[model samples]
Target chain A: MADEKPHCKVVLATNIAKSLLEEVQDGLAKIGRKPLLVGFLSSTDPAARVYAEWTGKTANENGFAFELREIDREELEDALLDANNDAAVDGIIVYYPIFGNRQDQYLQQIVSIDKDVEGLSHRYIFNMYQNIRFLDHANTKKSILPCTPLAVIKILEYLRIYNTILPYGNRLHGRTVTVINRSEVVGRPLAALLANDGACVYSVDINDVQQFTRGEGLRKRRHEVHEKPGWTLENCLPISDVVISGVPGDKYKVPANLLRDGAVCINFSSDRNFSPDVKEKASIYVPAIGKVTIVVLLRNLLRIVQNKIDAAAEASRENVSEAVQTSES
Target chain B: MADEKPHCKVVLATNIAKSLLEEVQDGLAKIGRKPLLVGFLSSTDPAARVYAEWTGKTANENGFAFELREIDREELEDALLDANNDAAVDGIIVYYPIFGNRQDQYLQQIVSIDKDVEGLSHRYIFNMYQNIRFLDHANTKKSILPCTPLAVIKILEYLRIYNTILPYGNRLHGRTVTVINRSEVVGRPLAALLANDGACVYSVDINDVQQFTRGEGLRKRRHEVHEKPGWTLENCLPISDVVISGVPGDKYKVPANLLRDGAVCINFSSDRNFSPDVKEKASIYVPAIGKVTIVVLLRNLLRIVQNKIDAAAEASRENVSEAVQTSES
Candidate 1:
């Protein structure tokens, strides 16, 4: 619904430093709002990319000005956390390697859910799955919906995917979406969100598919294992209309045998060399690596701030008036 | 700050019907703002309490109008859920259950955090904890908080039991507080909130605590147990400092020798009168059956609403405008 308007600012936090982010922050600053930036090391940036959209994009544009910062290892645990809270920064962005102690401690210290522009806080992500509306945290939510997920609904609507059912124009209502990968950023939280959205969703880490089991429950449950041949074609081909692959490899080998007829395929990889036979058979393709996430992040952040802005303002006004009355007395 | 001078409309929702909260709801209505009561119920009028608040005492005196209705479970869920996307409601409220489901699926069925009134949405609650800034569904944010928890806080604050800490603001900061149950309405969420508020919170369930090792890591961990004690404290008499017990009956006993010096004990079951010695030695005694929760519930709800009232009004206006656009289009 938020479309075609002039955007105020956009930032991209990388696994570099605040100083480094500042070097490139000008691109966002040019958008007429003060840009906030943060950079980690290259190893940390990929994981950080998932949440970058909100921090990079969703912020208060009115009188909105921000600065960039770069942080390191020891900083990830105790010290950097203090900076995150103490900086009184409007928003924070982090780009770090997808793994390691740095990532874990950094996550612990990254910031509060309210100020987490990257939306990396586990609490933030979990609540998104819960589907409650989140007000103060920009781009994060009661349900862990990123712009990509919401966009999926919009795209479904645009395409008018006839087989799907929409609940009052909500996209995720009745469709079945099976996501491959169980990383913190995508698989689990997204699946939770889709389930909350009323879709029958199946999330499996491709790496664990070898142990797939058809449990007594309605849907087949499976353990994830990478490199199991039958796992790809046998597990997903028959069930899902949409297959979202969030693995990093540029070219994933899926025999046409595994591509369900007219299934929509979303690739969250940067590899352009993906085989054509796959795309030729699939209904659609979306590369989530950089293209879709930026927009989604911005939209999500906007939703968060927009949700609560007025109430905070009013409360402040009330407090002011109360103070004034007491002063008069 | 949202004293009785202002007027506002509100909605209420819960697992139980709104009727259960009539007295308190009615009192809430009598406060500063003109009130509107909206509710969701499976059978009874849980929402009526909210109605009683808005149209109750103060609102009734102010001659402000209010409406109350019990919506269908499915319909209400659809309206509140982003997945279903029913976008008509303005604000949503939910009552506190002393003990109930902790999974949050039911809570997720409420409106998106956007229109959610009490800030009970999981993501919204986590978000609120981070910033400590209250937010309204659409516009303003003030001190709107969860009613029951706020009530608990009100009592604690009013009583001045917790003292100040140097940097973090109060003694609650980094203090190990353990909640023994997994109540979405109270136990689990509240512990998380306190931790987010800078307390060192240990949200211990029976499963976790029962499995806990006594040395090293947990040697100093806070222990909060809710299950009826299998073994009597008659054997283990190392008394702790703070005991907030929600267990029922006097079957379990706290022998005079079991309590540490200056330990503040909160007992939910007050009928089984404590020995005068036990009462006299204790620094604090909390009668948990009702007293604090009732008044706190009302004031907390009021704070949540008032803090963000101005912003909410703006959001309401915006919603109206959007509705107009929808009509025109």
Candidate 2:
């Protein structure tokens, strides 16, 4: 009895990442190139160092090239620009927590949209709307989505397949998904992506009430009345089929009883957003594995960008053929 | 009984349009310009003709310039380009249902994003995401939202005050808004806009299931799992706080029994989406008045574009001052 393992199915994020990395390598090799990603660490943050180490190791094991470099805050722009201009660099990712009190969001624009593996550029964020338009996956070739959201999606798919007892599979349609964080990096984008997939996404946060839950003083701001509903963590988690939290701390936020039976719990925050007993309560629990998710995310971006590049080349060939025909005639 | 009027208050869409127009005219006048719009009617459809006529009358009554031109199908692009190039033409609107069998979606792109008063351009459409970013209202000066959605928002605001019987005023936060159309011109954007504000938006349509709801064959299309739950016309109407429909045609689509008492009904379709008896059941009913909404929309767009232009000018002035200071130093 002491040796018996827990009854719940435990899914490994690294396994997901490894499978996706293989697919990406194959895709890049088909295009006569190796998977090359440049990781820029502009700060000495502990989290940043860990990510850089994992990325370097993963790249080596998968027969790919990963360059980890430390760039000063002032040189950050030049480093990104060089990567952008380099024909060999397939993708560029900047580790967060750059120097000073501000986020390094300004650097996101320096990376070419085509080579933006992090999916932080305005174009990528904007093009994410294409999903809502129901354009085929091919149409979304214009911009890559952020890694965390993409990882959340993959994990959800994984849970659907792994949890055979649950009636609802990977399909997000009609699934009540409650996202506990409303951040730009994880929670907000995940909500949008999930909603686009037809999931009833309840994006919950502590500060969502004044903005989402109650209509008030909507006087002079006529056309600006649009605000997303905010649900408290306690109220929304109970009803959620899939509960995802990205709160960036070590505290256990989600209670044991909050997650109903057969529910799937996913944490993106490096810190645990769920209680230790959550694994025992829920049908499936996906703990935060940033390294695994990042690998998978970069792989997805590589494949998407390759498709766009291939399509462009094909279009150019067609144009050349048409010009020759017209000239001959 | 014949002499007794219903206890409900009648909300006129035109009043809202007129007030907005006044504000727009004042805004333009401050910039030493008048509200000038050119309406290009490439189709002789009765609805298009009606819109053109109403636009002309409203422009003149508001001490603005409105020019209505009937152009050939082949000349549509040229006319739009001319308006785009013309400094006199502050706004350009092409009536729907152009000479072609298909909707003239291509023409939407021809209008520059800045001059696109209809908010049809891809850039403007994509940028509506700013609301999700919680950017201040002043920041949204860059893009104009689609007219129908803007009008729906305005109507909701109007209903908030007009429905004095209800304790909640003009705020849409926390309200469950059900949009009964999935078309880009209305429902989809409306849902995004509403959800951006704080309302729990339920986007419904007849065929949303086969495409957006069910997630089958989601393997190769990992990123393409676009699912929007399709709530049949019958199922979702009962739970909505504000029910807005853009289903075209003359027949009524919403039955009286579907709406809960105190629900607000809004129709953007020329034909009734709600049954005739909806007025009796709902606390307030706002019928689609295309002409009035269009005026309000055009006014809102004019103001937004003017603000952007003014903001740019102010920025340029500051830049020039800074440049001079640098050179002197």
CA lDDT of B302 in candidate 1?
Answer: 48
Candidate 2 lDDT, tens digit per residue, B1-329? 02222222335677657666667678667766566778888886897899788878877876667888889978889888988888777778888888455448888889866567777777677766434221246555445677878778776665441222112211232245678877877878777766554444567776762112111111111111144454454556655656888887776487767765446678888887877667554545777657557666567556655765777898999999999999999
* Winning model by lDDT: 2
Error of 2 at A154 (Å): 0.7
DockQ score of candidate 1? 0.01
DockQ, per model, reads 0.01, 0.01
In candidate 1, what are the lDDT values of residues A1-329, reduced to their tens digit? 11222111111122112332332334344444343334333335554644443443423332244343444554554544665565344344445553565556456445655555556666765556545545336633243254444444434433333212122312332245676766665566655555544444566665544222111111212212223444543665545656666656755544555654435555554453235555444434444435335434444343344333545777899999999999999
Query: Candidate 2 overall Cα lDDT vs. reference?
Result: 0.64
TM-score of each: 0.37, 0.46
Off by over 4 Å in 2: A1-7, A100-103, A129-142, A161-170, A209-231, B1-329
Q: Best candidate per TM-score, number? A: 2
lDDT of 2 by residue, A1-329 (tens): 02223223446677667666777678767767566788898877897889888877877776667888788878989888888888788778788878545446777778887677777878678656434331246554444678889888766665442222212211232245688778777777777777555355677766771121101111111111134554465666665657788787676488767665435678888888877777654556777767667677567556655766777898999999999999999
